[model samples]
Target: MPTWRPLTPNDITGLMQVANEIHPGLPERPEVFINRIALFPAGCLALEDEDGRLCGYAISHPIRRRCPPALDSVLVEISADADHYYVHDVAILPGLRGRGLAAECVARLLASDAAQGYSVAGLVSVYGTEAFWGRLGFRSVVVDEDLASKLREYGEDAVYLERVLDSQ
Candidate 1:
């Protein structure tokens, strides 16, 4: 079985390996992970198997609605007035799909201390995963010109999705 644990700087090597294998085209440098962990440690998670090997990772942080960070870019700082919890990224090994790991990750994130101030969660769905996100309570929402432009940075198929938190 795999369990979610706080991601630490020591896990960067394995984290990068998992990221490279899972998101070859949407690569992000280790600095991004380092920055996210430093900014909001509560939102950084690493899934490890019983053997203590990294199998997946999830990164979430409070961000302003209609404005998502660019792919492969580091957020110098979290928003001062961020209104929504953003699921920045979640990647799992192919072997771990269909085990509800993704949903568990998001559920834990939404119930995290870092997510307390947020009323909703947002994400930029890509790689034809709109249906998957839809199943997770996220629905595609049209964005303004500027936001739509940012979504393009992820991919042409990218769609902005949002889910209102149920107040746990």
Candidate 2:
């Protein structure tokens, strides 16, 4: 059986291992990652196996609007309705891919948000992953020329996507 929990300090090494699997060629310096842990530890979640080995992981946050405009960085521009949660940078282990684990993780995260009274979610697909995200109910948003350049700088082929969560 597998269990999930928030990551802790001792789990940093393991978390970095998992992160590297998803983002190859990323810097491996512990200090750099330590800064990330300090900044958004609550956003990181990990899955453990029966043996207590870290099998998978995911990151989530309640998309804040006080973000600086940066290319490639996620920006959570919520609609005026203000009843949505935007998901970002969701990844599962390669060995664990195609098992619906990503979807399960997303579902659990969204459920938690709904329990907290949120109603929708959104994210930006980096690699023209519209079909994959479409399966999760995220539709692409149209963008103008300047916005398109900014997205290119951020290394994304497309703009944002959003999914409205079902009420429990």
Candidate 3:
């Protein structure tokens, strides 16, 4: 079975490999992952096997609603008064699919103490994966003109989704 742990800088290369495999034609810079880890280590997680081989990763952090960040860009810091726990990206290795590892990763993330106090979770679904997120309880939301323009940077099919979390 795979184990979950906070992502480390050493895992950047392996994370990039999985990202490339899952996010073709999308821009995902290595520095962005590094910055995310630095900004909120608890929100950046990795899954590895007993042999310590990385198989999956999830990058998330608190952010303002309706203000999804752009793809492949770096942020100096997360918003201090952010209201939503934003899932920036999540990917599992091809060989590890069909085992519910992705759901496990998300569960771990949402349950983390860092995610506490947030009443909502959000993510920008790309690659027609909105159904996957929808199954996870996220519902499609219409974006404003400004946010819609930013979503275009991800791709035409990208859609924003949000889920209201149960009160803690």
Candidate topping TM-score: 1
- Which sequence of candidate numbers ranks them by TM-score, best first? 1, 3, 2
Model 1 Cα lDDT, one tens digit per residue, 1-168 = 899999888999989999999888888999999999999899999999989999999998988887888887888899998998999989899999999999999889988888996889999898999999989999999799999888888878999999999874
User: What are the per-residue Cα lDDT tens digits for candidate 2 across 27-133?
Assistant: 34445444434555655567877788787766555543212134324333323444446454565667767877777777777777332455656675765677888
Candidate 2 wrong stretches, greater than 4 Å: 25-43, 64-84, 113-115, 143-150, 153-158
**TM-scores for all candidates?**
0.96, 0.69, 0.95
Instruction: List ranges where model 3 is wrong by over 4 Å.
Output: none
**Span of ten consecutive residues with least summed lDDT in model 2:** 65-74
Best by lDDT: 1
Worst 10 residues of 3 by lDDT: 64-73
Considering lDDT, which of the candidate structures 1 and 2 is the better prediction for this target?
1
C-alpha lDDT of residue 7 in model 3:
97
Candidate 3 lDDT by residue in tens digits, 18-135: 8888888896899999999999999999989889988889999999887867889899788877989999988888788888888888888898898899999999888899988988
